[model samples]
Target: DIQKKKQGTFLPKEARIQPAAFSMAQVAKKPLPKAPAVSIQEEEEEEFKISTGMEPGKTYTGQKLDLDLQDIDLDNVFRLIAEVSNLNIIVSEKVKGKVTMRLKEVPWDQALDLILSTHKLGMIQQGNVVRIAPLKDLLDEEKERKRVKQERLQAKIEAAKRLQEAEIEAQERERKLRPFVTEFITLNYTKAKDFQAQIKDILTKEPKLERVGTAVVDERTNTVTITDYPEKIERIKQYKEKVDKPTPQVLIEARIVKATKNFARELGVQWGAQYAEYDKRGEWAWGVSSATGSGTTPPVTPSSWQSGSFTQGTGRDFFPLSGWMVNLPATLLPTPPGIGLQVGRLVGDLINLDLRLSAAEREGLTKIISRPKVMTLDNVEATIKQGREIPFTQVNPEGNVSVVYKEASLKTTVTPQISPDGRVRLKLDVTDDFPDRSNANPITGNPEIVKRQGTTEVLVRDGETVVIGGVLEETRATAEDGVPWLKDLPGLNWFFERKTRRHDQTELLIFVTPFIVQQD
Candidate 1:
């Protein structure tokens, strides 16, 4: 009745109220309930919901946004980005700068980062909540966290150190309470007393164990008794094992040859000739002959001294009138002619003799004095002697005469060191002593002692030979023989008398070879 007059409406259907308006009106009629009071932490948790299908601590790939902004507040920009990305953002009070940027289709997270960087601001994200603050405040918080972590680590280290010290103290106390153990070790080559001395020296250096360790030597059994803690005893046993093995032995073979300068080469040739003769007859024979004459007497052929079996033959006359010539058997033809020189024609033919002679002339030229082979322990000196001792009368201050013996001999002394690589280092001392018959004492008629000595050190491989030389001796002599009255005439001396000058030289050569003896 009150609305009897109906007003005409010109509103379009699209602009009229929809069915949702009734529900909205009903919702407004309900009393607005009071929101529960929330703490800052609760509010933050409520604002930030974990993103769906994303793990915590994962990099956020937020929604892309295209924004054209001009001098916008940094906090507003962060809020805008948070809204676009559906992320919870908290802006610090210290964040008050404005940013001007035009970003097209950039990730929301990246755009937020750009705004924060330009303003010297920083962010800390926990799950979906992002905190915005000044960079200085964030740096201070990070430093504080590191300082706390370092303090915790240092505390753990100190606790561990204290625990270790306590354990070491317990072990030391237990060791002191333990009884000493004794062990006996027998030595094969090394002296027990020597090793005991070494062990004593080692113990003296250890302040904690010096009083506890003892080493005693029993010479009768060549045994060393060690008394110490079990651990120290084991260490001593190991050390003894390293040093108590057998000492190596060295077999030194030495050849002492007194020869001329050309002896080595001439000896080689002589050996070759002997080998050739041996090949022809299956055996070789060497013969030597000598002839001596006072005046012009016809030379007599000496008997051939044979070294091997051969048929003897009657000699034929080769020279008719020359007293210097003699018929030699054909089998002894290889003997050097210089060995059979006649004393009558020796001065006349001496000028025509060859300086290089064969091995048959060894009696006057080259001689093998001695070949001494000795076996000795490594680093021990070995000596060899080949001559006699001479006696001399010594008158003391009391006017009593006594005989004193002096060694006049050829002696060789060598000390050899064996290396692990099968090499030998040798220290050599050689002495050659002889009587000088040409110079004799006036009253005693005793010859003066002539000594030649050589000393050297050399390194050579096992079983290898080394030669040592340089001791040389030289002699010169002159002789004249002829008819006495005719030789006295100065003008006719050349025709009647024969004068000869001879020069001789010899050297001492030592050939040494060392062999390492293998243990059986």
Candidate 2:
């Protein structure tokens, strides 16, 4: 068994001894120490380095060793190493184990490390003295050292934080004792009363000025009076400068257009041929005498009629003797001065006949444009209107007639917000009102009111126009004035009737444009 020693024995510095060989006879003379029973718990793997007492980057130049030993006392191996290296060695009582190693021409330090590793041992060197111990004890000692170092570092950081807070508190106390200075700040673009509460809130939140600082506004002079330390007053002034600048303005231009289109066609053919038979006296007579019978003809005449054929021979003008005849043009005649085609034909020779035809057509277009422009500050609303008010008569239950006026006008309301990048956002409400006299109230004789409204929001670039349209109205009508059965006839309808066809269309379109107004 290895004996416990009070102090580590040192070899003389000049005595660099090396044993040629180690035999079992020499090793067996000393009884091997019993291996300590170590219980190692599972832990997270960590990287650690032992202090070897050697300066950084230094190489070991000790003598090489060749050894073949079995069941050798571990403590005795360390003593042999200390003699060869001429260094003091201390071995822990817990470092008790038997080492069996075969090392060939290895450095003395490496031989010691191999034997220590085979027996689960570790070492730390101080100068030329080396101490050996169980690996588990060495690891526990290293962990405790790191933990203590961390605790000390944390304590130092906390102390520094407390010292800094104390310094801040002291500064705050000193600032609270300073004299208060009252300063007046005159605002150019913004009102002083608008910022009074905001400034007071800022000062009240500050630790040093919470109790003493005050902000008051004088509306007449447009100035804010601040009672605080000089530095704090300057800070408040800087903050005011940021938010009290000028607000931008936007000009909104809107155009409302109402277009009306009307188309009408009046086709009428008023054609008639009259037949009269004359007696030998050569005077016109309304009666036609046939060999079988004769009678007075009815006064009403057909719109399209033909009778008494006229024969135009060479240099000979012949009138009808047995039948009524008249000459009628095949094509449409030229229109008359007023409205429709008027054709009148007369054939002479004891026969008086007249033919008249009429036709008319018309087309018209009308456009009414209203331009309204309004300017307002950013995020403000503006309105423009142009129109009249109509009065309506109302009778209450007491039979009293009272007149109430209602607005019939074109109105536009817009709210514009100016973006930082020179774009405009618009909220629009447009209304158009008019009186419809075609459908009047029967009891009151008051015209009906027609209203058109639209509301929308849009984003547009500056100086750009946007158009909105979809209000449309259309009407179609046809009228006929003739005998009911005759007007519907296929081939002869045009000659027997007057037909009128009308088409009307109306549309409303709005164009909006925005311009950023630059202030001087």
Candidate 3:
């Protein structure tokens, strides 16, 4: 290993460990890299995600609209950048009344920035997604963004450290050199020595190239390919610095000191904690989702729930909610993998779900039944971009046919459950079978989802009424066609008593969030 040089002693200039001509005056410590004036947290905040309204591959004109909105009211206008020429503005001039405005200009990006900056009151930040809403939403986003300001600061610090390292490395290789060249390349690399020998051989064969350039480095895979050239080089073209080339001997035998507690704490088990912003759909609600359809919407519902057969002591509802609802299989697993032995604590973190303010359905109308967690992202696809070529001998029949079975998946379709986030989420999962649902449609890859659902039918009420063609004969009241039948039962919510279970049994509760039904 290349040991760092150790200091002999702190003495007079003459007693120092250096050439006799060396003096302390030549080295009054270069100010410690400006102690990064930035505070640790502040350093992190500097790592901002950069984006621009200015677009490339576009033509510009003198008549450009610069969208610069500096101050804005939250509940008034919905600003939308629809196109390069038109800005679609949905404005709520009055309560529940909306008017769409399409403002046009040549340089749309300029117009957009100008308008935005002009009305720029502030911005709202959440998670990594920031909502540039008016004062209220912007304030909320800022509160959330700043809530984790400490974290943001730390992230900035780490990013700055990385940048500093990169810049330093870049500056180090700024020596007087020539551009090393390697012409006519081929993969013939072996050991470094052998590679060097090969380079020499190549140079001996072709004299036009320059002195063996710094081994053509591939940082992507920390490996270097020796190159042969005639002259020396200045700086690496795009790559400004030469990677530190450790000797092979050093690599053969290296010692790794055990990581310290502080180090471990810095990069420890990174867990994902799922939680929505500190608010619900009180005035402005939002959510998005999708549901898989099945059984052709119950063949148009030929009949309704008939309790008249109670006299026969047999049928009425198929099986409570099971006949219809069927415990809508989650976007993921059915019972959500239990949180005990069988499930990994990190698994649920990947696709976390929660419903802080439960779904509200007041009237009998089914539309208010389940307000879905909006803007759902479902992966229903599998694709093999690289196809394997099947090699075969001449003797086999049907052997030459390369079987390329395309990936198929369940077409999990979702409706456009609009929300402030502008993503689709809420889903009405209509199905028939309880346990074995979605059928054997092996959802292998990205399944094609239908958004505007018009297939499923919501059967409210339908019954058989036998009548003599337009002749209305007086029928007995409270009787089912001369057959005595029990009266329709009133609906009720029967409470199922709860019972405690042993610690061994699972008790993981899932939170289903209503992330869709929000204010526009």
Candidate 4:
């Protein structure tokens, strides 16, 4: 066992080997070669090529350079030149495009000039910094600078002339006012308190008058006394004469007109028109018109009139209407989004409902009354547009499609302009969109909307009414009068299914008027 253990523990010579000691003879060093001398020009050119351009803040020595760049980027040229000149050159945002130049050993300044000239650019130098901008901008700046200089010179000359004139005026005023300065003067004037401040202001502002003492007034006799230069005294006398003149009275009469009727008597009867005092200036009168329709017009009802008033002065007035009358069917009401509905006399004599609902409420009511597959009157919407377009999206079985809003909003645009002769010029634009049920089929969703637009420019006098009419709309309503299954029978369909047909014709009328109110 011992002999086997000793053989197993034997060490190899290579495994126990040590590293050899260091020797200078084993390592050899080589000498570095000297670089060739380069000219300043050549060194700069080499640096320009390597660096492409100069940094904005870095400075360089002014050195001559020979560059012959063709079809090279202008930005690269600016950078190379910047590096050679050792200048902080900044290119403005206005500078664009490339530049090509061919030059022989040129000074930095000369090269910069040539480049700027070729590009229609100008350079501004401040200390060691340089900025390049459009040539026109620099020229404009120069013109403005010259203009300012000329103005300054002219202002100085004017100021000197004014000072001389003031001095001369003072001497003349002193000579003329010396005699009256010691004399006491009294004048009779009404409203002495109102004139006292004015008289003192006139005396104080007159530099040449040489006035002394403030004005003294006696309210009992309406007399004012003052001691001042003779010129100031004469001026006060002239002022007193002017103030003593009688003030003219002005009376303003305001007339309220029903505007619907041509006679002024009708206005008095409708609104109990009477002159109501407004301060001391004038009077204002207002009246109301009789109601012809219960918010909805008959298919052929007479047009209602607008209310207005007139005064003998220039003023602005507003004529607002709650809503217009339309004879369209209840089912065909154009209850588009953001619209208000006032239900009155439903389609035909069968339904006589007078209710007002918003667009959303009308839609809900339609769902309860109409079949899901059938298109009801609510399916049709009336739209109005005035010099503007509204867009909407329509979804079909295939996909969602975008469509421009062609429906008239039933709204009108009214602009009033006044002329020198007291005549009012009005510009009116009215637009309406109604559904065309004739093209609507059970298969298709709905037919396209019928569009109506009207515009007119008219001239009228204040309190005169302008009525715009000739707009006609027709709508149809059909109701089934038989049982569901029996109406669909093949042989007896006509007898079992009877459709009650009704046709409605409606018209829209617009009334506009201008009134003049007295200004305070």
Candidate 5:
């Protein structure tokens, strides 16, 4: 019994209650399982560092990437947008561990044979870091955060990439401008001859002149003058911007001669900016100013006589156009800006004027609208009776009244006619889609014009009205006073568009047939 109690610990209680076949020795004699080697992960936990923010060395506390992994690759656009992350990696168990240089910002879940990318690993939350990889690689992370975090990361990355690209483009432009510094110089000259003389004067006066700065000034009187020597001048940067090609419009070559104010006169308003020159009396000259040039706005280029024209505004084909006016050239010339869209608009006023569609062009359009083949003709008539007989009135048996077939009289209309004095008469048009005989029907442009040829279905897209002449002329009551029920009378705007189908052809015929009224 004591032995049984000791064995009870080794054997399950239920098993002990039952009759057992093997003893403890037999059970011990069975081989023990070789304990499998377990790779202790504790040491690996320490090697990883947490980072966040712009700091380079810090490790993210924890992160998760949420990406709606599309089937297509974003083509490495990840770097162009994300800003926070510094390093990213792409991993593959295939190729016996091959890797590509993972530039940051890989998209999530693109089609790749077998490759995974990670922005952060090592037991971090990963919410802040944004990286992109294939859909299959999503499980590769040691840990993952929620989806909202991934979107934020992606947006940041895109913004960063855009800024970086802009910087690079700017740098390239500066490189190009480096050589032009020696060759290009700004000088204010009134005439071509004067400019040449000014350059010669510059050669004699300035010593070791690597670069020169010039500005245009106006005389106290309304003439333009040039100031050759500038005390302190800002560099004229040549930046590359995408500009659409120019289209033709009215061209004007004018200067701001008469400004509204003395202060505006002093600033040398630029011709292409959003400023006005008001005189001391509060009167003003509109358009652009040249005294201070663009001021806070962008620049307006000065025009040359030959290449002087520039495109103005947008989609504006003519001058003296809406919200714009004309200014004569050789007025008060503002400082020469190379040219701008505004200046182009100003120039357009003088040279091109406004070129609206000419009379000939308008007439040409009129001829087309009134041409034959465009306006098809059809025959319309009344069918009160067979063989063209008049309709008559009749009373039905139920004490009800009705119009007999002979009671109705039909008025006739022919095609447009010209008088006998050199006037050509137009006969009633019998319209047919195909050259065929007209059935005894008096409808215009039958929808089932080819019904004889066997057409089963027709789809009505739109419908219109063709008024009968006599029905349109008659009014039930005075239209002037519109007394009480007079406006509600049947014939006033009460007519219906009539359509009937032929028995044999099933052709649809529409007519402006007449209807009678009931009197009190």
Candidate 6:
């Protein structure tokens, strides 16, 4: 049993946990990796120092370079050279492309040249620093600078040539014109030597002859020698003919006239009464008259004694009892004025009074007639002058070219005829463009252009006025004297509004006057 108990103790939890702990300690007892004999980074740093031969914070002299780099960047090779020589070398962005070079025991500059030349790069040595640039870019920049210099030199040469040509032209002109000044012309005149003095005096007054030179006339030979330009010499030859001709002058006048008129009317309805009687001559009294008062006889009725005659206080000083038969209240009855009396026969209780005022009114007529205004037509200056002819060019149409004379759009011509008696006639022909609506195209809705031509001819003397046009009629109506909100009411607004209608006749008269201008 004891032997069984010993085997049981070996099968318990402690025996199982002890074997796991022993295996974990055996795994934890493993040995770490061995340390290196010599430091690789230190060896590399030492080799780098030997290869570069450079110290920090010290000026650098170039050292020998031995490099064997393949398919490396150009900037990387430049960095290697900068370390070896301890020199400040900057690479520009333009220094690009890969490099593959092999060199042995060469100077740093020579070694740098081999690496950079393969990639077409060049360095600029500026004091202690070097700058890298592409060789192609430098060559192109130099070529462009030379081209610009050549262009400037060529421009200067052309300017000098132009100046020399102008000087030669002036000298040639002076040489050709020198001979004409000394030439003389002989003239045979029937008049005395006084005629030679007259010719000399005329040439002196002429500015063109005096500008180039002057004239010398000899009375003994009766010969004239004029020192002037060739064009002036031609005018001198024709001086005798021009003096014999007479100059003509004329005077012209033009006048411009305008009229305006106003008319007003009042429309209303009134209820009133009037009476009239027949006279002794069987003729009716002229107009209706109003009844005065109780003691007075009615002015419109005939008297009792005269039978048919109407009398005003004739032998009847006192009012008869018959005159007081129909009494009317003095305060309630209204009397119409004499100016408001109707002219025709009156019959109804409400008589329509037709008022008429003649044009021979003597008072208060200024309101009906417009005030007169004085206007002067001196603002526009005359464009057509006595001796000047002005030419005007017309603009071309949108889609047409006027190459042929017959196919031209319009032609206007003006001709002025002047007489010696101060009578002037203006002949004007105006061709206007009009749309041809009668022959409009049905599909395109386009109308052809038609030319309507008219001619105007008028004759007038100097300082005379001419008038054209008559009265024109126009009507204007406006709703005035009413409240805005009440006038717009649907049906009951007519009482709140009063409309004013004006009939106007306006006459615009154009007065044109022409005056003669004297020239010196």
Candidate 5: tens digits of C-alpha lDDT, residues 177-208:
44321232333223323333434433213223
- State which candidate, 3 or 6, has the greater TM-score: 6
lDDT of candidate 6 vs native?
Answer: 0.40
lDDT of 3 by residue, 371-434 (tens): 2222332221111111122222232365553333332221222232333433322232211111
For model 3 the TM-score comes to 0.14
Model 4: lowest-lDDT 10 consecutive positions: 370-379
- Evaluate model 3: give its lDDT: 0.27
- Ten contiguous residues with the weakest lDDT in model 6: 337-346
Error of 6 at 329 (Å): 59
What TM-score quantifies how close candidate 6 is to the native fold? 0.23
| Candidate with the larger lDDT of 1 and 5 | 1
Candidate 4 RMSD to the correct structure: 35.4
lDDT of 2 by residue, 1-520 (tens): 3333223443233222334474323433443343333233212233346643333564656667776656667776787676566667779998777766766666787677667666777776655656688778888988896897688789999999999999998988877666788988998888888878667756644643555678888999999898877788888888888988888988887655554421110111112232232323433222211111223322222121212322222221112233323222122112110111112111221111111111111122324356778888898888867789989989999999999999998776788888666767777676667777667899998888877565655555677554444344456789879877887899998878987999866544455677899988
| Residue 38 displacement (Å), model 1 | 19
Residue pairs with clashing backbones, model 1: none
Candidate 5's C-alpha runs over 4 A off are 1-27, 37-241, 244-520
Distance (Å) between predicted and true CA of 91, model 3? 99
Error of 6 at 28 (Å): 99
For each candidate, what is the lDDT? 0.58, 0.58, 0.27, 0.45, 0.26, 0.40
Decide which is better by TM-score, 2 or 5: 2
Tens digit of per-residue lDDT, candidate 4, span 1-520: 1122122332222111111231212211212123344476653333111111222453533455555555655555665555444566777788876655655555656666667777788776544456677777766766766686689789999999999999988887766655545333344434677778778766744444544546777777666776666677778878888775433211111111111121111111111211111112433232222223223232321222233233333232222122332222212234231111111111111111112112323533211111111111111222222233434446677886656564434555555555555555555565555555565646444555655555545455655654443444455788888878988989988988787888754334333444544334
> On a 0 to 100 scale, what is the lDDT of residue 273 in model 3?
13
Model 3 misplaced regions, further than 4 Å: 1-221, 226-234, 241-406, 410-520
Candidate 2's C-alpha runs over 4 A off are 1-62, 67-76, 93-104, 117-120, 126-128, 178-182, 191-236, 239-243, 250-373, 392-404, 415-428, 435-449, 455-518
